[model samples]
Target: MSKTRCLLLAVMAYDRYVAICDPLRYSLVMNRGFCVRLVVGSWMAAVPIQVGQTYQVFTLPFCASHHLHHFFCDVPPLLELACADTFWSRVTLHAVILLFAVLPFSMIVISYVRIIRTVLKMHSAPGRHKAFSTCSSHLTVLTLFYGSATAVYFKHCSRDLADTDKYLALSYTVLTPMFNPVIYSMRNREVRIALRKLLWGK
Candidate 1:
């Protein structure tokens, strides 16, 4: 599940970057046909990624039976149970996670930071407010998503890191996605306008 979601997020981040950096060319470059291809590409790439992660998770030859941990069976917690030599798989997964999971997320953050800077530089108040209306919801969602993910990945657990880690993880895992649509729907003028037009026969 995490593996699948990670792939989905990768494609989303890629699309978001293209849209933000070159809105004029985005439709041409990531047209409907190409967008379909990107979705397929994300799945194609996900095969190798999931295979590698699965390999690292179940490869340890001397692991004990008690494999579950922290609400779900993650690769890292399973690796911890392995009494055998998992130095290589551990190192590999660590590298892959940093490269795939962490890297795209960082790109999202950078893109938003760039967006905010650009929006803030607009000349008129209405233009500035309108620009912010497009991005503020996304910014809030990013903060919640990244905040929880970083907490979980960095081993900031409930007992050791803080009692809040569990709730934080749940926030990102369960609530963040749900809240994203809400935040965007309410704060994004375009979305609200569309909704109003749809509901009020405008």
Candidate 2:
């Protein structure tokens, strides 16, 4: 799921970049075959790492007491159970998060910066408004998703994950997905039209 989402987000950032920055070449750049390959590549890249990470955690010997403080069974919470040395595990975890989260996030930021610059240079007010509206929903989703995940996993100490962090995790897992469609509906004319047609046969 994490791998799929990261890949999707990366593709989305590129889609928006092409759409906003090089509208003339958007179709040529983002054709159907290109998109399919991106999806397949994301799965291939993310699966091996996720499998390896899962195996590493489950193989660790836990102490006599078995309890998890967090709401879910992710890497950080599971590591708290390790009876063995955890320095390398923690380092690997951080590196994975940096690769999946920080790197994609940096690409998104760079794309948006170029997008904003391009939008501002547009001569037509309506064109600029349309461009901003198109990117706003994606930007909001990116912020909510990354902001919560970063707060949860990137902490200096995994043992410090409080109940509040659990709520934040909930927001990351639950609220982000829930609000994605809502944000799109509000900001996206095509989505609203499609929803209306589906619901009311309009």
List all candidate RMSDs to the true structure.
4.5, 3.3
Worst 10-residue lDDT window for candidate 2 reads 153-162
Off by over 4 Å in 2: 158-161, 190-202
> How far off is model 1, as Cα RMSD?
4.5
Question: Number of the top candidate by TM-score?
Answer: 2
Candidate 2 local lDDT, residue 126: 100
lDDT of each: 0.67, 0.83
Task: Tell me the tens digit of each residue's lDDT in model 2 across 121-188.
Answer: 99999999999888888888888888888787766664455776778888888899999889877776
TM-score against native, each model? 0.73, 0.88
Q: Give the C-alpha lDDT of model 1.
A: 0.67
